[model samples]
Target: MAYCRCLTPAANQMLVLVSRQSPPYCSIRTMFVSTRRPHKALLKTLHASRRRPSVIRWQSQSAPKKRLLNITPQSLLVAALITGMVAAVYIWLEWKKFVHQAGGRIAALSDSGIGTLNWTLTDQNGKRREYAEFRGQWLILYFGFTHCPDICPEELEKLVEVVEGIDGNPSTPDIQPIFITLDPGRDTVEYMHKYCKDFSPKLIGFTGTTEEIDTVAKSFKTYYSLGEKDEDGDYIVDHTILMYLINPDGKIVDVYDKSAKADGIIRGSIKHISEHEKLRRKTFLPF
Candidate 1:
């Protein structure tokens, strides 16, 4: 009886082990486990992982992107290049227009029948003179002020060289060089007299009232403007730098810009004035 009892227990243990190992019994156990312990913990873990914000990663990526957008060297270079090109084109266009307009005006003056300009004004010595007084001679007229910093001196030097060259040539027509002060207010007769003496003994200086100066400037089509007042209420005058070549008939035969060399000016003035004189001699004779 003891042996049978022991055998019965052993048989039950074997039966339980077999049932746990068998597929059908294992499936029934798995079903019981799935139902009793819902996979709630696993599902919740997965949901939390999905809901977790990737805020740190996104912020790190955005910092580099923002830096790239804000600090781009190529953008600055492109902007500067565009600005430089625009400025260059504008300057070129302006220069072209100035040259074209200046050329057209010169052509019109050459064709116009304005003859010559005539006027009378006081010299630096306070002596009255007339443009007619310089008749039968070529006059090289330069309009400027004493206060001019650079251009006036340069033009005056060129004029001196040109007059000297003409005087050297016996065949060349006589050229009476004249210096007219656009700033008569500052350049008094006494100042002009001394200034003229310094330049050349033959250089005649002229000054007049502001109104008279304006009239003369207008007749020559010269432009001038007053600069800003200084600390002492003094101002500068900016005037045209053109040199006018007048024939013996006192007509504005030609105009020379500041670029015309001294030699060229002398040659051109002598040739033009001599031609006019020859023509005049033919027209009027004392035979």
Candidate 2:
């Protein structure tokens, strides 16, 4: 139900005239209107004022790209942690290599205590520990009594500096610092523990029966002479002041005296350890 409003007054008059004429002219008018208009113009227009608007769509848009990996904050943190661990392991391996280098000069003062440094002494916890327990690590052997008012403490503190110096270094093997009492009668396990803790936790205090201590001292060529007890029952003891650096296989590598500085001890110990490692490798393999 649509009405055709002609473009001109003449066309409108002609349409009216055709309407007044017979059906043949009406058929011709229909054909003329049908051939010359858009579909919207030809649609039913009972409510012509309420015409709908035309719509258009485009077809060139695309989706966003896909990533190979979507890295989040958590993923970044994990990667950093893994990288740190790898670096730590690499540093550790390099340190081991440094400790295994073949050429370092240490003037081992005495070879008398070289092959004979085995003992089973009581540890700070009063536990019986064998000399073989310190096999795998380099030994910083010291023999002194806890009761010494001056020399023993002074020497032990100095020894601590040396052992800790090596310990703080990354390019070195572990050095196990040992304190064996020359005056075992007074230096009980509890006493030894208390005294050694005053110096360093890394210092392992050891004591045993008088006979056992005597045997151990004799093996390392260390001497101790006890003085007479006073009215209060307190006594004094004189002992050797030496720091022996022994290798993993219980062979003495270097000897340090009171004159030996911390740096000297560390340098000599590292060099000696490296040398012993080289020797061990040579022993097992012909090449």
Candidate 3:
């Protein structure tokens, strides 16, 4: 027969006692089992299970998700306004720089009696016209002979491109293109009309006597020299390759040299036009 003697749990172990009855002897034995490790493991499992649901529940019930940007019409309009303001500021700075450079040259030209320069010449339509007749209109003036080999044609082509570019934009002001012949002996009214037509219909050609041409050229600060005649009696007239931009008040606003491109000239013209309008407004308001 075997009987349990004692079973007790201590601090970190459990004690088990047993008794056995043999035929002629009785025996007792003690055994020990570790309970602390298993007890701690069970406790840890219970705590983790209790904590898992709370964390998930809190995330689903109480935590708020971050909102992403929604592109509504109002947001788009605000963004457009910001972009336009930046562009306007940049354009204003550029316009200021242009004026700072051009103001001095224009002042010096005005001081040299250029502001009073006027001419009486014949237009391509065989009509006598004076330069003063073009007052109150923006003008781009070029001096070249109809028989120019290459340079005059190229410059006239660029000038036409610029004029068209300006006129093409409805918001921008239109510009009148005037071509004054440096070689009046050959560039007659009919020849000037044909030459101007070859470039652009908007171009108006002018021709006058030697004294009238010289006076206009000098007043406009342009130089020209006739080259030696070739075997076929064809001569080249070398002159300044520049297009003068004049405001409506007959004052020079800007000068585009040979290096100026059509797009650049168009931009410069628009800038000058805007500035001129602003000045006119200030004159009326004086504010």
Candidate 4:
């Protein structure tokens, strides 16, 4: 609200003005008293301020981006060291597992009696060869005759299973399963060949003169006795039932008696073989 008072001698008058409701103008109430007229520029300025609406402006500013990966030479070296430590730990764990699975230390032979002796005998192939020819090979030796009906056949079948078990593993060395007949007179080349095939193709049946057979049997510490003959000239040869596990060096490493099963023999063979490989590796040196 604005009031203008004009004070002249004969023309005395009062003027009232009302302006629109705006921020500064609506908040002001004033009375103007003067004998002179108001300036036009001042009036125009007041009118312009009341007619326009107030404006508030806003501005948006961009900020600098932060890095996701700050890679430096020191950081790269630390990462490599951590990876190397993890790899080393993994390798150590694997080695310990292998050692545990390979079984206990293999016992060394006290006497080399069986290792030194070599007997010339006739193989199933009709080839007369010395036992020395089988050197540098693993051997599983069993002494039995083909004529024995029950024990010999059962033992030979078990021997086949043992050999197959060893052969089934690629990491283990090959084994020569030797079957030496106590009665060589009856087990000729052809007869031994057929008999061995009945058990396993890997089996090698050997037959020789009584003196040669005696020499090997004595050296191996095996025993055998001939039973009374029957009407058909068939007699059972009572012999020692054992399997000798010999290493590549021709030394007897272990022996399995009658009570040992196929799985036991298989485990024992693998254990001994793994130990043999470890020993061989330790002894070998490349300069």
Candidate 5:
């Protein structure tokens, strides 16, 4: 039998304390372990197990870090695109609103600014007739050339009838019939003088230089162009067939086209004139 030695845990602890206090040669080594009862090995294993629990706690505390509110490049790109689209839509809506408001303002300005009624031109008698002179009278203004073979003559005849009708009706404003020639190159004062007499004694004719006529036409928004000239330097003139009705206050209150009839002009002129008179008397002042 092999020899072995062992002690109880309390005895072994007492012996270890005494061995530490004594010299190295006095330590009893054979009593520390036994094959049948290995208490020292068991104690070492228990201490290692305790250290393992501390490592386990460290692992639990340092578990995979959770991602809270994490942002990636792809997510960032998507958010930026969404924000840009929303901003573009908002800006576009505001731009449309601004354009709509501007369009309305421009239309209102156009209506008030175009076809104004302030101009001066020389009449057939070589006399200057300032537009202000006819401010108090109702103006029946026509723009055409004496060379107009059919439309001008017929329109002027109709104008004569209108004048005669106005003369008979005292309710209407005293209408001054005017014929302004668009063809300054062909029509002279003598030519228009003859043309007016053929229509009515009450009708007055007006002619001016080419530049003056162009200025008046532009102000009135009358369209006219010289047609192809013949070998003899004569050409037909293309123009807008329109007649204007000027109020006593020198404002263009109405216009008539070729399709307009006598009754319409008569009724419209009378109505507008009566309305003006009513307004004037209502706001009348004595100076």
Candidate 6:
């Protein structure tokens, strides 16, 4: 066995060193020293750790992210339904405007005859009558002669239907259907009397002198001319196929063409007269 020993220097004494040699036997010696130094690899690792968090924060801020939720089939269906509803509403509004404009145009183009008139004439019964007698009622004044072959009869039939239609309705205003003879010379008072009886009982025929008929026709702006004589030495009268709608005050408010059916005549006349009466009542004050 081998042994080792330690020695300490005394105060104010010189330092001394000593060594010992041992025999050729197994022995071991050891010495220990400590020094202060910085760890470079540890500092580099700490810096990398701090920079990694900053890099991750920047990437998260710069990247694009979806804000809304994912779209579904239900959402798509809702979108399509809304679009269809909007389109339907737009189409309906356009169609309504188009119809309104078309009706206005038609009303504007239809016949509108001359205004009011005052006259005196002879009835089919040879009784004298004044135009003022027909006041406070609607009047359908037609100018034609019994000598007319086609137009007169056709017009007379239409007038008969119109008269029946108005008389059939309880709500419509009372109206007088008048047939003034354009051929006063040929359509004698007796002939007109018989002719009126053939048509509706409500029809009234008027006849008078040539000058009187001419005056009345001019007042209404009616067009009538003698046509060529037929094979039997009989002449026909060509006249306008106008049906005049006269108001209660003997004023020609409107005129309808021959194309107007009985139903249309009744409906349009009633509508216009009712509306006009309502307006007049609202605005007029009894004196």
Residue 107 displacement in candidate 1 (angstroms): 11
The CA-based lDDT of model 4 is what? 0.79
lDDT of 1 by residue, 1-287 (tens): 00011124323211111122233333111111133344565445445646654332222244443444654799899989999999888867765664455445544675674334567789988999887898878788999998788889889889988889888888776688999989989999999988888889989999999998888888788899999998998887877789988766566768889889988988787766555654455421223
Off by over 4 Å in 1: 1-117, 281-287
lDDT of 5: 0.73
- 11-86 in candidate 2: lDDT tens per residue? 4211211222233333223322333444453343323423533233345578898998989999999999999999
> What are the lDDT scores of the predictions, listed in order?
0.73, 0.73, 0.79, 0.79, 0.73, 0.72
Q: Which residue pairs collide in model 3, if any?
A: none
- Report clashes for each candidate as comma-separated counts: 1, 0, 0, 0, 0, 0
Candidate 6: residue pairs that collide: none
lDDT of 6: 0.72
Candidate 2 backbone collisions, by pair: none
Q: Candidate 1: how many backbone clashes?
A: 1
- Model 2, residue 220: distance off in Å is 0.4
RMSD of each: 20.2, 15.6, 12.7, 11.5, 19.7, 19.5
TM per candidate: 0.58, 0.59, 0.63, 0.61, 0.58, 0.59
Point out the worst 10-residue segment of candidate 1 by lDDT: 12-21
Model 3 lDDT at residue 271: 80
lDDT of 5 at 105: 42
Candidate 4: tens digits of C-alpha lDDT, residues 1-287: 34355545655343344444554434433334343665565566558756765443445488888999999999999999999999888867765665554422232343546545878899999999898888899999999998887888988889899999999999898899999999987899999999999888889999988999988898888898888889998888888899999888777878899999999999999988877776566421231
